[model samples]
Target chain A: MERTPITVSALNAYLKAKFDADRQLGDILLKAEVSNFKRNSSGHLYFSLKDENSQVSAVMFAGPAASLKFRPKDGDRVLVEGSVAIYVPYGQYQVYVRKMTDVGTGDLWLEYERLKQKLEAEGLFRPERKRPLPGFPKAVGVVTSPTGAAVRDVINIIGRRWPLARIIVYPTSVQGTEAKDSIVRAIAKANADARVDVLIVGRGGGSIEDLWPFNEEAVAYAIRDSKLPVVSAVGHETDFTIADFVADLRAPTPSGAAELVVPDRRALLDQLDVLARKLDYVLAKTLSAARDRLSSVASSYVFRTPERLLEKASVRLAHLDERLDLVRPDRLLADRKANLGHAETRLSSRFMAILAAAGYAYGRCAGRLELVNPLSIMTRGYAVIRKDGRIVRSVDELVQDDHLDVRLSDGSADCRVLAVRKGE
Target chain B: MAQEQELKFEEALKRLETLVRELEQGDLPLETAVAKYNEGLALAKRCHDLLKQAEEVVVKIADGETLQDFPKQRE
Candidate 1:
């Protein structure tokens, strides 16, 4: 040992050599929770690996950090494979991480992937399995921790969007050992209540272990069994759970679930206002159209000039009058009257001539008959006489008691025959 | 009324939209149009009343079989 004053640099270099010489220090493995994790712009990762009793500063260069499977976040449990080295400049021993992995996570990741594949094969996450959300939810059932910020966000958002729905908070332990059963029970209760039309099952952001209940098989089955449609809002936006897959709707956050559960009252009112205005507009158009029809009828020629109704009849009558003028019924009647007068005169003259001829002929016949009639000469001083039934032509044949009949033109007389003469 | 309560908000909105469309079509007779307009006015009133009367939301916490009122907590 040189008993001279050695600079701090030389002391640090000596310690660096010692640490490099040890084979155990060259390659080592450690399990600790990541804290104060940071990635600068240059891509180097700086973090502290802490445990229950102690903490160690660690650094992974840009090369290893770029090849990392996951982005190292704060509070993450990681398995680090690196070499211990004393940085001479700082005179401190730190881990120069080469390969790092999440601790106690590989098994859980394999299980998640395996279950995801199995459930996907069973069509649980199929698009058809998703139910359509109601346009308006009468009651919204929230299945989460009652005291958590998630439930508060949901309540506040729902109150803003739609306060009409009765929000039934089915208080459930969203995390920890009994979270799986509590969530299932809450879902079942909400369904049994039959008051809620939709359900939002979720919690605020948390670590993977805190969000594990949503990935459980029991929670998935509960969502599937629920009659009311379930909206899964689990953890942060990046977190995906089995409940998200099995739910009818998957919202990125609890606030998003509240938004999806009900319609905006203001928007609904706007729509209603539009419809009311449309109703009035249409009714007005209908009324106007009716008025137009009435006015059209009123302004029609038939209505404007009522006398036109008889114009056709009057024209028809005029045409009939013209036809009657062509026919000349009065002229025809006058001609018939003249014909009647001529016929009457001719008929009377013919009848009178016939009567005159008969009278003349009868007179001639009567004169001839008078010349042959012996009693007709009585009027010319001629007489027709018979004595008793014989003429006294001879005195010898006469009897003094013979009766005689004398005939005259006007009358006949009976005389007793005192004497009878033959042919006297 | 219980029956009126059964009318869903969405269904009521849909019926109102339909009434508006029918009234707008202008093909209905005067009598039917007037009746439909009256019905539309009634529906509008119902919807308006629902909006104006902002009843406090019923926030209840489920505990086993029974439900109890949840305190109104503000963020």
Candidate 2:
């Protein structure tokens, strides 16, 4: 192998071509810690990926760097996925990083997935088991670090959105070795207090290590066993945890949970106020109508001459008392409701016909109500008895000592048969 | 008919017109005048809530974009 040696530029060029042609060298995945991270004004990322024994420089252009879920700072453990390339100008080799993610979170994600499947298998995350949140929550309990942005956002939103609801902060450490137990305890306390209408469990966005408590199995069970409806608001929009699965509702963020928990009162105030006015209008109409009837009745000579009115009433009562022997009051009432329903159908159909012609009116409601008013039927002191579904017209309809419903204009009475006279 | 019963805009406005005329004339019987005045006051209060009667529901977020409402779904 005796020969002239090749030039440095020629050798590097050849090495670069070899690196590009080789498939294994083209595609490589290195799990290493980031070091010497730097960024120039051009938006290209410069860093070294190092493990215990070896190190390699890497560059992620602005486009790919912007897509990274986690920032690659110094000492950040990352799994850099890209191709290996020879820098022919520098006569050195480096990785061209396409994607980079924090290694710690990757493992946490795997753990999260495993626990989610396990809990889901036990039906803890069943949709049917999730309780419906109260439409009007008087108090909302939040289990989060009281000092974090999450609690502040929830409180602020709830206050502005629905001031009627009281925000009760069940403060807890959201991360670290003790965070899992702290969250579990805080949830328990909220349930035990039993004052809050609903519970919100979450924390602000953070790294996986900071969000690990929410992914804990204990937190999932705590949420599952909650008495009040649990709303899970974990990290950013993309993060998912075991607690989210077990919660009745999973909000993308803490502020979103607040919006969902209680409706904005600005919208509801109008509805309630409208109903209140209608209530007043309906009541006033009833009063004025009653006054009109009273004045008209007062002017009648029959009321002035009391004996005349009494005599007429007694005679009518005698006739009705005679009819009372044949029928029960309950059957009569049911028949009246049935007739009213039929009338309502007929009147409503006519109402629809008039409405189709764009003709609408009021004042007929009182007359329609009068048709169903049992008081009008009993006005003359008439008392009738009904048996089964028919008016009792004969003593044959009765039995000895039978209890009968004696109906009157005022009300019905349960009358026991003292005696029965046949053809009397 | 139930829907018609809830359409109180026409009734409220007509009543208000009659009430203003009656009040303006100042000849209504004392009790009638008092009752009419109260009814007028209630109708005025209802007007405040309406801003104007709107058939469709519109969600007004404090500082958000205009969002339309979906039709109610019944089970």
Which numbered prediction scores highest in TM-score against the true structure?
Answer: 1
Residues A149-214, model 2: lDDT tens digits: 887788778767765555677778999999999999888888876547798999999876788899
Which residue pairs clash within candidate 2? Answer: A324-A385, A326-A392, A327-A385, A327-A386, A327-A387, A327-A392, A328-A386, A328-A387, A378-A409
TM-scores for every candidate against the unseen true structure? 0.66, 0.47
Q: Which pairs clash inside model 1?
A: A388-A403, A388-A404, A392-A421, A392-A422, A393-A421, A393-A422
lDDT of each: 0.85, 0.77
- Estimate, for each residue in A1-424, the C-alpha lDDT of model 1 and write its tens digit: 7698999999999999999999999999998999999888998999999999999899999998877755578888899999999999999899999998877565767777888898888788989888898776778999999999999899888888787877899999988889999999889889888778899999999877789899898888889889999999999897888899999999999999999988888887898898888888888888889999999999999889989978999999999998887579897788788999989999999999999999999999988997888666787776556665654444565477756576778887886657656666
Model 1: fraction of the reference interface contacts it also forms: 0.78
Docking class of 2: incorrect
Quality of candidate 1 docking, DockQ: 0.53
Candidate 2: TM of chain A?
A: 0.53
lDDT tens digits, residue span B29-63, model 2? 65776677687777756643443333322211111
